[model samples]
Target chain A: MTDSSVPATALEVRLASRPAGWPTTDNFEIAEAPVPEPGPGQILVRNKAMSVDPYMRGRMSAAKSYVAPFEIGKPLDGGAVGEVVSSNSDDFSTGQQVLHALGWREYAAVDASQATTVADDLPSSAFLGVLGMPGMTAYVGLMDKARFQQGDTVFVSGAAGAVGSLVGQLAKLNGAERVIGSAGSAEKVRLLTERFGFDAAFNYKDAPVGEQLREAAPNGIDVYFDNVGGDHLEAAIGTMNDFGRIAACGAISQYNATEAQPGPRNMFQFVTKRLSMQGFIVNDNGHLKREFFEHVAPLVREGRLIHEETFVDGLRNAPEAFLGVLRGDNTGKMIVNV
Target chain B: MTDSSVPATALEVRLASRPAGWPTTDNFEIAEAPVPEPGPGQILVRNKAMSVDPYMRGRMSAAKSYVAPFEIGKPLDGGAVGEVVSSNSDDFSTGQQVLHALGWREYAAVDASQATTVADDLPSSAFLGVLGMPGMTAYVGLMDKARFQQGDTVFVSGAAGAVGSLVGQLAKLNGAERVIGSAGSAEKVRLLTERFGFDAAFNYKDAPVGEQLREAAPNGIDVYFDNVGGDHLEAAIGTMNDFGRIAACGAISQYNATEAQPGPRNMFQFVTKRLSMQGFIVNDNGHLKREFFEHVAPLVREGRLIHEETFVDGLRNAPEAFLGVLRGDNTGKMIVNV
Candidate 1:
C-alpha cells in the first residue's frame, strides 16, 4: 500500500465481552474496519509481532487497574514491532522496523516520531519481546528499584514467563550469589535452572512455596521479585531476611480471580524483619533507561540473554495468543506474527 | 545509697510471667539488688521516670518482634529517664537528669558512659518522649523513611499517642498542607484538632476510618504514619494517592487480635497506586542517634514541640501503665514515676 492508501481492514478478535472467571473464546470476536490513511507525521507500519501478557486480563475487564480496560469491539493494544511500509515523516523510512503501542491489527498508521526505533543489531521481533517493556522491567526493577546488592539472594516467581526469565538471568549477571525461581511445571523449572542459569528452580505444583523457598534459600531471601502474588507472596514474606526489599512488579496468580484475593497471611513478618515492599511499574525510572540499553544490548548481541517467544501466525490468531498468555501456556513472550 | 562511702543498693521490678494478651500486676515483681557499681565508662543514676510502649507486648510474650523478648524473672528494659544520683565517670554526675533503656525500675546504677545526657535546655521528661526514642521514630519515619515532602497530606493513626501526636505536629511543621489524625474518642479528636492543630481529626470509635478519612482528606493522602494497623491501615490504603508512602511504625490494633485479622481486602490498591510500605524500629537504626537529638532538642527548647506524660505514681503501677497503653487508653507517653 502507498502512503495515501486507505484500504478496508479486518481484525479476527476484539474483546467481545468481559470474562467472569476465565476469559473463554467467547470473550473476543473477529471484526473489520476501514484501513486508516497515514496523516502528516504518520507512517503506516505492517505489524510483524505483537504481545499478550497476563496483565492484559486486568485490562480486559472494565474494573480499575494500572492501565485502562480494553473497550468492546476495539482492538487491544500492547507492545508491537513492525516494518514501516509507507511514511509521511522524515524520521521514519519505508523499510525500518519500529516498536510502539500498536493494537492487534493488520496495519497501523502511527506518528513517525512516536515509538522507539528497534535496535538494528537484533531481530525486529526482539523489540516486541525481550528488548522492550519486559526487558526494561527486569533491568530497572533489579538495579534501580529493588536495589539488589552484588551478593544478594534473589527469588523470582512466575520464573518461566517473559519478565521472570529475564529477571533470573539479570540477577546472576549482576553478581547475585544465588538466584532461585519458581514456575508451574517441571520443564519450566529445568529451563530456569539449567538454561536461564538460576541457581535453584522449583515446580510450584510439587511443593508449597514456603517449603520450596526455605530449601532453596537457607540463608534467607534478600530480594524478591514477585510476579504471582497470592501464595507466592506469602511464602516470600515468610523467608525474607532483615532489611529485605521486595519489588512487586506483577501479581499474575490472582489477576483473573472473580473474588478478591486474600493477601499474604504473614504480613506481620514484615514488621519483624524491617522489610520494605514497594509496588512498581516500569516507566523508565529516568536514569535506568540508558543503563538498561547499554547493559542489555551487548548481552543480546552475544546471545547471553536467550529469548523464547510463542508466535501465533496472522492477525486472526492474536486473540488466541493473548488468551494463551493468561493461561500460562506460553513458554516466554506470547506474540502474534501478523 | 551514697556515691562514695555507701554500698550500692537498688530497687527494681523484674518480669515474673508472660501475659496472655494484656500484661497484669502479677507479671512483674519487685526485687532489691546491689546498685550497679559503674566501672570504666559506666554511670550510676537514680531513675525518675520510665517509658512503656505497646511494643513491650512482644517483649513480654516470647513472640519474635523487632526487638528481643524479655527474659522471664528478669527486669524488662525500655526508654527510661533518671537523675544521676552518683557518678564514677566524667560524662555524668550526681543530680543530672539522664535517659537510658532501664524500664520497670527505680534508682538504676547505669554506667555513666552508657547514658545519654538529657539536653540541658529541654525538659527532662522529654528524654522519654519527643527528644528520645519516640521523637526519633517520628522524625526518621517522616523524613528518611517516608520521604515526606512539602504540601503532602498526611494521616496519623493513634493520633493522641506519643509517636502519632509528634508525627502530626512534625508533618505540619515540615510544610504539610493538610494533616489529619484518627483517635479513639471525641476528647482525643478535639485534642488532635484543636490542641495539636491537626487539619482534621475523627474519632475512629464512632465511624469507619475509611469513610472518615475520605471525608477529611477528600483530595487523597500522600503519607500515612501507620501506628494502629488493621482497619486503620485498610482505611489508609483506600485513601492513598499514587506513589503514596506508608511508614509502618506500630500496629497496636492488630497486636491483641484474638483471631486472624481479615487483611485489607483491597490491598491491590498498592499496585494501582504504586505504594511503598516500610517497617522500622528506632533502636535498630542507631546511626541516626546524633541526628535525631540534634533535630529535636531545639524544637523542644523553643516549645515548638510538646510531650504529654501520662504518669503512674510508683513502680508498683508500672504494670497498669503498660496495660493501659495496650488498651489504647493512654493519651500520650505512658510513664511510671518511681
Candidate 2:
C-alpha cells in the first residue's frame, strides 16, 4: 500500500545524449513515470533530497570507467536519502528514512538489501555530503592515498569544493604545519581561508598556478590533494617538496575537455625529488567507510566540522544543479531538493 | 707513502664549463696533476676502470638536483675500481684491489674509510656496474618502488641501458608473466629479446611508443620501469592497467633537451586507472642495499644474471665516453678503462 502523500506519477531525469565536451541541459530529459510499486523484499521511497556530484559527469560519457556509463533513455542514478513510504520487506517499516543509490527521481523502488536505515539525528542531506561519499573521499585521499604525515604542509586544489574543503580542514586538524588552497574565484579563495581555516588561499584565475603556488608554499608542499587537475597538478608538482606525495582524487578541470590535457612539464621532478603520486576510487575503498563514520561523524555532530549545501528546489532542475556544479557555481555540495 | 708504480703525474678529466643542452667534448679538459702521497688513514690507488652513467648528465648541469653539480675546473668523481698500491692505515695494505669514488683520474689519494675491499670473484669492473649502483637501482626500483607482483606484465624503456636491462631481467626472474622492452635501434631490440629474455621488444624510433607498446602489451602493463621519459612515459601511462605502478628511475630522453619537455598528456588515466608512480635516488635507499646484494649477488655469481659493459680506454677519453652514453652509443654499462 502507498502512503497518502505518494503521487500517481513522478518526474525522473533521463540521459538523452552523451556529451562530447561540456554537457548542457539538452543532454537530459525530465519525464513523468508512474511511482514504482515495491516488489517482494523491496521498498518504495519518496526521495526528499538527492546528490548532484562532479563524478556524475564521467558517467554521462560513453567511455569505460570505474563506474558504468549512464545508459541513454534510462533514468540516471546516484546517492539519495528518502522516507520509506511502502515496504514489502521486514527490515524496513513505513515512515523510516533510508539512504540508497537510486537518485535523480522523486520516488524509487529499491531492494531492502540496498537501503540502509538512517537516524534523524542530523539533516538527511548531510549524509549526501559531509557524512558520506565526499567525506570518505577526503579522508581516504589525504590520510591513506597521500600518506599525510603530522608535520606535512598540504596544498589542495579546488579548495572550496566538497572534497577539497574537507582535505584542507582535515590537514589543519591533523597537525599540518601549513595548509594552502587554490580556487577559481576571489570569493571561493576568501572562503577557503576565512571559513575553511586554510592558512593561505589563491584565486587560480588571477595568475599562473605555478607562480601562485610558489608564492603560497615558498618552503614547498609535502602533500597535495588534487581535485582539479591540469594546471593545478603541474603547479603542485613544481611546488612539492622532496619526497612529496600527491593524491589524485579527481580532475574536474579535464573532465569536460574535448581533448586530453598535457600533464606536468616537470615530471622529471618525480625522479629528482623522489615524489610519489597515487590515484584511487572511493567505491574500491569501502573498507574505510565504517572507520570514516566512526571518526568524522561525532566531529560533525559537535559542530566542529562544517559543511555547506547549495540546494536547487525541484527534481526537474536537477540537471541545472549538475551543470552548475560542473561550472563551479556551488560551494561545498550541490543538492537537489526533490 | 706513495706507490712505486705511481707516475709523477696522472691525467684527470675536469669539467671546463657547464653545457647548455647536449654536452660536447669542449665542456671537458684533460689536465695532468701530481700523484699525491697518502696522508694518515689514506690509500693511494692506481685506477683500473670508471663508470660513465646517464645520471652523470644531471650532475653536469648547473641546476639544483639530487646530486651536486660538477664544479668547473674540478676533477669529476664517480664509481671506480682500482688497486690500492700504497696505504697509511691498518685498514688497507699494498696491492689490495679496492673500490672507491675517485674516477676520471688515473691515480687517487682516497680515504681508507671511503674505500672498500672487493673480491676478485668477478671482473672488478662488475663492482661499478651489475654488482654496484646500477644493479641496486634496478632492484629497488622494480621490487620496492613499482611493487612488482608475480604474474604481472613488466615494461622497461631504454631496455639496452644499464639500469633498464637489469630491471627487465629481474622482472623475468621474479616470475613476471611477460616482459616488454623499448630501445633506440633494431640491434638493441634484438639484444632485449634474445640476450635479455624479454617477451617482446620494440625500436621506439620505428613507430610511436604508444602504438608499439600497445601492440606489444595488448593486455596492458602492470609495472613500468621508466628510464626514458617524455614520449615513452606518456605511452606507458596510456598502456598501463588499473593499479599499475611506474618506477621513475631516469629520463634520458629529456636530459639534453634545452627546454623542459611536456610530460604525458593522458595523466587523467592516473585517476581512471588508479595508477601509482614513484621516484627514487639510489643513495637515499641505503637501507635496502644489504637485502638487494644478498638477494641478487648469488644470481650474478651463478651466471643466472648476465651483464655487458662497453669500455673506452684512457682517462683523457672519459669525456667522449660520457658524451657517447648520452647519445645511446653504448649497449650496456659504459665505462672508461684507465
Candidate 3:
C-alpha cells in the first residue's frame, strides 16, 4: 500500500469530443492515469475542489476565443484549490494549500510559480469562486468596464449565476442607488432579492424582459451587466439612461444557439442616449488581481460578501458539474470535490 | 424686387407632416413669411446655402433623440451659411458672412450669438459642408469616440457622404496605417479610393458586405467609423482586430426601415476581441470645438483638406434635396442653394 499522503493514480476528466451545440456526457471521457511526479519548480497537488463555469462552454469548441480551446483527449484545466503533497520548488512546502489552473483531476503536477498561495482562514474552495476568477470578473466588469458610479442604478442579467450574483452584490456594496436583477427561475430571483440584497428581481421567463425591466427600473438604469445576452440586451438598451454603460460579459442564452441570434433591434438608442457598450475578458485585466483580492478578501472573511457553491462530489463527476453549469442547474459557483 | 440683397418675403420650407418611414416632397410645404427685423442680440440673415444630411431623418421623426423633434407646420432647422442683412448686436454686422443653425429657409432672424463669423476666402457654402457640423462629426467620431491611434487601420462606411468622406481623409492625415471605405455605387467607391486617398474602397452593393470587407481588410481593422450600420456594422465586427473600436456615427442604412432593423449578428466578437463601441452626438463634445477648428481650419485654408457639395438650387427643392440624400443621390455634402 502507498503512503496515505500520496496517491498512486489520478482519475481525470478529458475532453473526448468538441461539442456541436449543447454538451452531453458523451463529450467527456473519464480516464485513470498514473500520478505525475513534481519536476523542477513544480509541485504535486491533491486537489480538494475545482470550478465548473459557463465560460468552459466556449473552450469546449474549436472556435477561437479569449482563451485557447481544450484539446480533445486532454484533461480539461480550470480553477482548482488543492494541498501540496510534494514540492520540488523552494517557494512551497508539503501541506501548503494553493490555487492553480490545473483542474478536472484528483491530483495535478503544477508549476509552483503558477500556483497562488491562498489564505487558510476561509474555505479553500472560496479561492475557486468568490475570491477567484468569478469574483474578479464581477469586480472588473463593474468597476472598469461598466464604470460603476456611486449612485448609479444598475441592472444585472443572469443574477443567479456565479459572476452575475457577485456583480449585483458588488454594485450594492459600492453604493448603487438601486440594484435590479433578472434570473431564469423564481427561486433564483428570490435568492437575488433576499440573499444578494438586490433592490428588485424578476424571472425573465414570467413576462417579456422589456416590460419587466421597465417596471423594475422605472427611472432607467445607468449601468447594465450583461450575462445572458439576447433579449436581456435588447431590454437593457430600451431602458438605458443617457450616458449609460453596458459591460458585455457572458451570453449564456446564446451559447448553445446553432443559428445566429438576432441582435438588439433598438441599437439606435445607443446614439440617442449617448450610451457606451464594452466587452471584456477577465484574463485581459490581470493587473487588477491584487486590487480585487485586497478589496474582496476582507469582505469575504467577514461574511459581508456572501458566496454559495453547489458541489458535485468526486472528480469523476466534473463533466456533469460543467454540464450542469451550462444548463443553469446549479446556483452560485458549481464545483466538483475531488 | 425690393432689393436683390434683401428680399421682402423669405421663402421657407416647413414640416407639413412627420414622416412615417421614407419622406416625400408632400411631407414639406413651401411658405412665404415676412422677413423679420433683428431683435436684441439677433441678426436677420439672407441664407446663401443650407445642408441636408442623414441626421435630419431622425429629427423628422417624432421619436425622442439627441435633438428635439421638429415640430409639425414649423420651419425646419439645420446648418446654414449666409450674409447678415441686419444686426442688433456688436457680435455681427450687416453684409458679414456667418454660419448658423437656421436652414430650410431663404432668410433667417438668428441670434448673433448663434452665428459664427467665417473668412470670406472660402465660398459661404463651405461652412455648411467642410467647415461645419459634418467636419466636426468626423473629427470627434475618429479622435474622441473611436480613440483612433496614429497607426490604426481604419474602415469607414458611407465613404462618399460628408462625414465618411472626411473620416477617411482625416484618418490618413492623422497617420493611419491603412484606410478602407465602403460606398453604395461604383462611382462613389472609385471616388473614395482615387479622390479621398483611401487605400481600398468597395461597392457594398456589388457583393456581400462581409466578403468585401474581408478582402479589403485582410489583416483586420483597428478602428471602424460606422456611418452606415446594419450590414456594415456586422462586417466590421467580423474583421476587427483585438481591442478594436467602433464609433457609431450614423446608421443611415437602417434609418428609414419601417420595422425594427436587425442588429449585427456577430456582436459576440465584441467580447472575444475586447472591443469598445460608443455612440455620440457632436453637441456632446462641444469642448473639442476650439481644438478641432485650430487643427482643421488651416488644413481647409491651405487646400490640404478637400470638400465637395452637390447643390440643389432654390428653397422649393430643399425637400427633394433631402429626399435625394436619403436615396444616396448626392456624392458628397448635399446642399441647398437658397
Candidate 4:
C-alpha cells in the first residue's frame, strides 16, 4: 500500500482549440493527470504508438461526419498500439501487447473490450496499418464491393500512403493484369513500382492526371481505389473502361480547403462510361475483416506485402504528425511513438 | 406463288440526319419495303410499338455505349414490342406476343432467342414500362445495388417517368418509411403521390431542391435513386444520412447541355456524409432480370404497379415522341404505334 497510497498518474494530450483552417501545432496541448485504477471491465494501457490519418483532419473540424467531431479539451482518439499495464478484466492482462483507440497520449485507461488482440507474429503496429481498418478497406472495396476479377486492370490514388500502397499490392497479388498508382513525388512513384509491385505509378503534380493516367493505363482501368479525390479522380475517370468500378475511400485533396472547389470535373464521365463509383466507410464492411487478415497476413509473412512507417517522437508532435500525413509527407504509415 | 413466298415487306424508320440540338421531325424518315425473311434462328415480328429514351440522344450524337450508336441514314434500334408472325427457331412460335430489339419502323426480323414471350394478361406497352429495362434498372438499383433496407427514407428525382415512378412506388411497397419524389411539374408532383404512392412529392422548380429535400427528409435520406441528377444530386448529398447510398440512373439535366455547366458546387458534402453515389447501365444487372420479373409481375398484375404510356399514332411521329419524352412532356413511357 506504500506505493499505491501516492495514487497513480498518466500524461495526456488533448485538443485545446478547434482549427480555423489547417490545424496548426497550437491546436493540441499536453496535460498531466492522475491515472485512475481500472474499474471493472476496464484496462490501463501504456500506449506505445498511435496513428495519424487524413480523415482525422475532418474530425478536428466542427463539420459532421460518420464519426462524431473531436470534443475540445478532450484527448483525440484513433488507432493505437499499446501494452496493458494493469487490468481489472479477464479479457486483458499485464504484458499483453494490444491495439486500441487511444491517441495523442502517453497512457490510457479504457475498457478491455475496446482493445483488439493483434496476432502475435505480426507487428503490433500493423494493427494500425495493413492489418487494420485501412487494409480491410482496400481488400473489401477492391474484391467484394467492386466484384473485382482476375486479369482486370487496377488503379490507385495516393498510392504511397498506407492504405493505397496495400491497395496496389493486393490488386497485383490478386492476379490483376495491370496495377497503376498516382502519387505526389517521383520517389513515391518509383517506390510504388519498384518496392510495392505496382505495374505503373505517376507523379500527379508534374502531369495532368488524365493525360498521365491514360499513358499508365493504356487499355483503361477496370477498378480504381481513390484516396486523393480531386484531379486524380478526374483523370481516373477518363481512363476507366466501360462498366469500371471506383471505390472512393478518401478525398485528401479536398480535406483542408479553406475555400470550396468543384472537384474532379470529369464526374460526368461516369455516365458516358457507365461506371460505378462507390464511397464506403470500411468498418461497416466488417463481414470481410476475417478474410482480409487471412489473405494479407500470409502475404506479409511471404514478403509480398511491403509497408513503411514514418514515426514521430512524443505525443506532443501528434498534431504535426497529422498535418504531415494530410500533406503527404509520410511515405507510408504515419505513426507516433508515445 | 403464295403472298407469303413474296416475303411481305416491312416499313423501316431510319435517322435521316443528326439533330442540331434537340431533335426535330426532319431527323427521322420512314420508308416501306419488303418484310425481312427470318433466318435460321430468326423470327419476323409485327411490331406493335417502339420506345424512345433520353439516352438515345447520346446514341444519335455518335457517342458509344454497350450498344452501337444509330448511324446517320440507318435505323435507330431500341426496345420494341411485337408479335411473332413467323419463327425459324424453337425458342419462338408463330402468333405469340413477344418483345424484341428492333428499330423505329414497323415489322422486324430478329433472332428468335432474342425475343421472350410476354404474358397475355399484361398490356403490350407494359413491356416497355414496368416490365422492361427501365423497371429492372430502378428495381435492381434499389433492391440490390443500393441495398435499400426497410424503414429507410428514399428520395427519387424524375419521379413521374417510367423509371422513377417505379422507383418511388417500389420504395414504398418495400417498406420505406418516407418515399419522397421530385418532378418537373405540379401535375407530375401530384401524380407521384396519388398514382405512384410517394409519401410526398415536390416540384423542383417551385423551390430549391436542397431546401425542399431538407424539409421533406428532416431525418435525412437513406437512399437516393437519381434520374434527374445535377442539382438534385447536390441537394441529395446535403440531405443524406450517414452512409447514404445514391444510385445514379441518369442525369437528364446535363444530358443535352453542350458544355458541362460547372458541376455541383457542394462537393464537400460527399466526404462529410460518407455518401456513396454509383452509376449503372441496365445490362450490368442482367442477373437480376428473372428475379426482377418474378418480384414485379405480381405487383403489376394486382394493380399495385400503375404504369403510364404516351403513344403516337405512327412511325412518322417517332421523332416528336422522342423530343417530347426528353422535354418531360410524357407522363411515363413514350412509344410509337408503328
Candidate 5:
C-alpha cells in the first residue's frame, strides 16, 4: 500500500443537532474531509467496519452521563476496526488489522498507542461486536457484576441485542441451571432460546414482563443482566430469589423517553429478598479484558458462541443504522460497513 | 422470686382483624391469658418493655413477606426485654434481665434458648432499640451493606426512627464528612441536628425530598440509609454522587399502602452515576453482632450516643404504640412498657 493509492478525500458522519426525542437521520450529516497521512507514532487506517451501539444515544445528547456528549459538527467516534494502510510507528505495519475508537468514518489516522492489533482469525467486524466492547460488557456484567454462580438461574433483558445475546450464552456455557431472556419480538425470543441456548425466552411486548418472566422462571432468577430497564427491571425484581443480583448494564427503554420513567414498583422487595443491584460502565472495567478474552475468545474461535452482526452497508447510512439500533430493528450487533 | 410472684392472668394484644389501609384501634383486641410456668429449658419472663416497630405492620397482613404473618387471634411477637422470674435452663438465672421475642404480652413463658440476658449498664428499653435489632440493623446497613467510608457524605431517611437514628450518629462517629437526615416532623428535624449530631436535617413533608436533599448535600451524597422508601429512595438516587451506595433498611412509607407504589423515576441515574443499592434484613447479618456491640455499646455507655424512646404504658396499649410507630409519632424507639 502506498500514499498514491490512498484516497485523497473520504466521508465521515457528524452530529448535525441533538434530537428532542427519538433521533432521525436529519440529526446526522455526512461531510467530506481530506484523509491525512500517519504522523509520528500514528497509523493511517482504512476503516472496514464501525459499531453503532445503544449507549451512543447517551453521548448524542448534551446531558451529563458516564461518557462525554458528542460535540456537534464533529465526526462521531466509537468502536471501529480497520487495516493499517500506512504506518509511522514501530508497533504496527501495513496490512495489519487494528481496533480503535475512530468509527463513523472511512479512514482514520489513529495513534499507534490508542489502537490495538487484533487477530486475523476472526472477521474484522468481530472486533466491534463479540471480541470487542459488547462482548467484554457481557462478560464483566454477568461474571463479575452479577456474580453469576454455577447452577444459578440467570435472566437477561434485550436478549437478542449485541451484549444481551452473549450474556445468556455465557451463563449457559458457564453451567447455569436455566437461562431466561426477554426480547421485544417473537423472532428475537426464538433467537434467544434456539441460538443462544437460553432455556426459556419470552416476547416482553406480548404481555406484561412480570407475568411472562414469572411464567418463564417459575422458581425465580438468581442473576439478572439488565439491558432493558423499566418493566423488565421491575419484573426481574419481582421474580428474583433471595440474595439475587441485578447488573444494570443499560436502560434502553428510557433512553428516548421525554420524561424520566418510573422504576420498579416492587423495590420494597429489595429489602424482603435481600437483593443487590449495581450499575456499571464497561469502560471502567478494562482490567478484566485479558481474563475475558482468555475465556471468551476460545468460545468464539471454536464456534461455540454465536458472534452475530447486523451490518448496514456504507458510512453514508451510519445514521440510519444508529436509528435502527434505537428502534430495535437489528437482531444482534448492529454494524456500519465503511 | 417464686412462681407465685408471676401473675396468673396477663393482658395480651391480639389482631382483632387486619386493616385495609390505615389501621385503627378497632383492629386490635386486649385479651387475657393465663401466664404459664417455665417448661423444661424455659424461662418465665415478666415482660417489662416491648418494641412497637413499623415492621410489625407487614406481619399484620396475610401478604407474603420475609417473616410469617401475625396470627389473627394470637399475641404479636417482637423484641421485648423482661425479668426472668424462673429459669429451668442453666443458661439463665432467676431475676436476670433477658431479651426475647415474646412482646405484646404482660408475661411470657419463653424458651431459654430464645432469650439472651442483657446487661444492666443501659436502660431495659435500650435492649429493644439501640442495643438490639434496630441497633444491629443500623450497624450492618451502614458498615457492611452500604460499605460506608470515612469522609463520605451520609443521608438517612426516617432519621428520628430507631434504625435510622443510629445510622447518622454511627456514620458521624466513624468520621463522615457530613451527615444529612430527613424526618417527618419539624421537631424531629431539629433533634437530628441538635441531639443526634447530624450536619443537616430536613422535614421530608416540608418540601420535595429531592429538592431538600440537594440543598442539604450540594456536592451529592455517597451513602443513603433508606428507612422510608418511595420518594426518599428516588430523591437519594437523584442526589447521589458517582459510586454512591444505598442501604435499603426498610420502606416504612409503603408498609401500609394498599397497593404497590411506583419506585424511583430517575433510576437511570443508577447507571449514569454507577450507583449500588442493596436491601438487607438485620437477621441475615447477625455475624456482625460482636463487632456492632464492641463499637456501639461503648458509645451508648459513654453517653456519646442517644437511645431515645417514646414509651406507651401497659401491654393493653401495645397496638396504639405500634400505630404510633406507623404514624411516625415516636421520636426514636417506640416502646410498649408492660
Candidate 6:
C-alpha cells in the first residue's frame, strides 16, 4: 500500500447531550472532520496533550456563568499543548510548540496570538498543568486573592489535586507557620505530607471535616484555599481564625449535583471572625503571568516544586478523562494524550 | 414629695437569663444600685440616652464572638450619651457631654480614657445614634470594607433602620449613580425613597426579595450593604454584577432564628461573578472615627443629612425598646431615654 492510503482526517470529541446530574460516556460523541487550513495570522496545531479541569463542568451546562456553555454538536475546547504543523503567521513557526485553549481534538486552527510559545527545556505537556492555568490559579488565589502572610497558617481543601497541591507547596515555601490539607483518600493524605511537605494532612472521609480540621489546626487557620465547596467550606469557616481570608478557586464537590446543596449554615461565623472571602477565576488575573513564571519556573526546574499528571491516551478517551476529574479518580492534573 | 425625699439610686437593666432564641421582657431584670463614685482616672456619668442595637442580640447569646456575651445577672452595656457628673481626671468636668460603652443604666462609672467628648453644637443623644456606633458602622462598611465606588449602583438591606438608613444616604451624597433600598414595611419603603433620597425603594415583605431587587435594580447592583441577611443576602447575591462587593455589617433576620438558617445556596454565583464579601465590626475600625465625623457632622448641621430616633422613655422600658429592635418595630435608631 502507498503512504497516501493513510487517512488525513482529524478525530474530535463533541458534546452529544447536556448532563442531568453526573455526566456519562453517552454525553460525549466521537467524530472525524477534515483537517482545517490556517488563514493569515492563524496556525494549525496537532495537539499532543490536553487538560480536563473541574471548571469545564460549569461550562458544560447551558447556564449563565462567566464563560459561555459548550454548545451541543460542537467540539469541546480547553487547555492544550501541541506542535504547530502549519503556520500562516510570522510569529509562529511550523515546528514551534505552543499552548492554547483548543483541546479534546487532534488538530486545532487558532489565531497565533491566542497560542503561547513554551520553553524547549521541559516536557511540552508541563504547559497544560503546572506551568499553565492550574499553576496560575494557585499563585493568584494565594498571593493576590487570599493575601497570604509570611507566617500565616494555611489550610487547603482537595490537596491532592493539581491546583490544590501547588497551593500547599507555595504556602510552605513562602514561610507559612503551618500548612494543613484535606484529601479524599488516605494515600493522597500521605502524599500531601511526605511528597508536598505539608505539616499535617487528613482524609476528609475519616471523620467530620470540622472536627478533623480543628484537630489538624488547633491554633486555627488564617488562610483557606478552597477547591472543594459544600462541607469543606463549612468546616473551614468553623476553624478559621479572627480576620481570616478565604480564596475560593473552585467548588468541585458540588459541580455535578442535580439540586442546589445546602450552604454553610454557620455563615454567621464570618461576621464573628471578621472574615473576608473572595471568589476568582485565573483568567481575570492574567496580568500576573510574568510574575508567576518568574517565581515558580526556577523552583520547578530545580526540583524544589513537584508536579504529577495522570494521562489517558487518545482523543477518543478525552471524555473519560474529564469524567475522572469530576469523580476525583485521578491525582494532580488529568490530561489526555492525543 | 420633698426634694430631700428623692432617692439617690440609679436604675439599671440587667440580663436576667440568656435568650434561647428571641429575647423577651422576662429576659431582663430591673434593678437599682447606688450611683457609682468616680475613682482616679475615672468619671461618673449621668446617662441621658442609650442605644439598643441589633448587635446586642449576638451579645445576649453565650457563643463566643468578637465581643463578650452579656453575663446573666450583670448589667448590659452598649453605646450611651450622658453628662459627666463626677470626674477624678483632669480631662473632663462635671457638665461635659460624653459618649461611652456604658448603656442600659441611668449612671455609669467609666474610665476617662473610654469616654469620648462630644461637640457642643449637636444634642447629647445624637452621640448615641447619628454620631456614634451606628454612624461609624455605615461609614466603615461602605468606604472601607465594601470599597464603594463613586458612581456604583448601591443597594442597602434593612434600609429604614439606623445603619441602613445612613448607608443609603451616604451612597447618594457620595455620588452613587443609583441608590436602591429594601425595607420591611410600606411606610419605611416610602421613607427610604422620599426622605432618604434613594432612587428606588421596595418593601421586601410585599414580594420575593429576588424579584423585587431585579425590578428595582434592572442593571444589577455593584455594592450591597447587608444589614438584614438570610433572604436579603440571597437576593443580593442573585442580582449582583461582576466583581461586586458585599459588606456584611449585620444579619438581623437570622439573629433571632432558633434553627440555623440556610445560607445563600447560590453562592456559586460568587465564583462566576468574582464577588468579594467581608464581615466587619465597627469596634475593630475605631481609627476611622475622625474621618467619619469630619465627613458626616457638617452634613447633619447643614440639614443635608437627616437623623431620626424612636425613643422609649425611662429605664424600666429599656427591655421593650431592645425587643422592638429585634422585631423591627421602630424606624431609625431605637433608644432608651434614661
Pick the winner on DockQ between candidates 2 and 6. 2
What does candidate 2's lDDT look like per residue over B1-338, in tens digits?
A: 45666779889999999999999999999999988888999999999999999999999988889999999999999999999888998999888899999898999999998999987888898898888899999999999999999999999999999888899999999999999999999999999999999999999999899999999999999999999899999999999999999999999999999998887888888999999999998889989988999988899999888887899998888999999999999987998899
- Runs of candidate 3 with Cα error greater than 4 angstroms are A1-4, B1-5
lDDT of 5 by residue, A135-209 (tens): 999999999999999999999999899999999899989999999988888888888877888899999889998
Which stretches of candidate 1 lie above 4 Å from their native place?
A1-12, A284-287, B1-9
lDDT of 6 by residue, B1-338 (tens): 11232248979999999988888999999999887767889988888889999899999999888899999999999999988887888898888889999999988989999998999999877788788888899999999999999999999999899998999999999999999999888889899888989999999889999999999999999999999888898899989999999998989888989998988787877788999999999999978988999999988899888878899999899999999988888888888898
Q: Which model scores highest in DockQ?
A: 2
User: What pairs collide in candidate 5?
Assistant: none
Worst-scoring 10-residue span by lDDT in model 1 chain B = B1-10
TM-score of model 2's chain A, to 2 decimals? 0.98
lDDT tens readout by residue for model 5, B1-338: 35567767888888889889889998889998898777899988999999988888888888888899999998889999999888888898888999999988888889988999998878899888999999999999999999999999999999999888899999999999999999999999999999999999999999998999999999999999999899999999989999999999899889888888888898788788989999999989878999999999999989998878898988877877888889999998888879
Error (Å) of candidate 4 at residue B86 is 5.4
Interface root mean square deviation for model 4, in Å?
2.4
Please give the CA lDDT of all the candidate structures.
0.82, 0.92, 0.90, 0.82, 0.91, 0.90
Score every model by TM-score: 0.96, 0.98, 0.97, 0.92, 0.98, 0.96
lDDT of 4 by residue, A215-261 (tens): 98889999988887777777787789988988778888877778766
Candidate 5 segments exceeding 4 Å error: A1-3
Interface RMSD of every candidate? Answer: 1.7, 0.8, 1.0, 2.4, 0.9, 0.9
Best-fitting candidate, scored by lDDT: 2
Better of 4 and 5 by TM-score: 5
After TM-score superposition, the amount by which residue B290's alpha carbon in candidate 2 deviates from its true location, in angstroms, is: 1.2
Predicted candidate 1 versus true structure: per-residue lDDT over B103-167, tens digit per residue: 67776667655687766666677788887778899998888788899999999999899999999
Per-model root-mean-square deviation over C-alphas: 2.1, 1.2, 1.9, 3.0, 1.4, 2.7
Candidate 2 lDDT at B200 equals: 99
Clashing pairs in 6: none
On DockQ, the stronger of 2 and 4 is 2
Q: Which stretches of candidate 2 lie over 4 Å from their true place?
A: A1-4
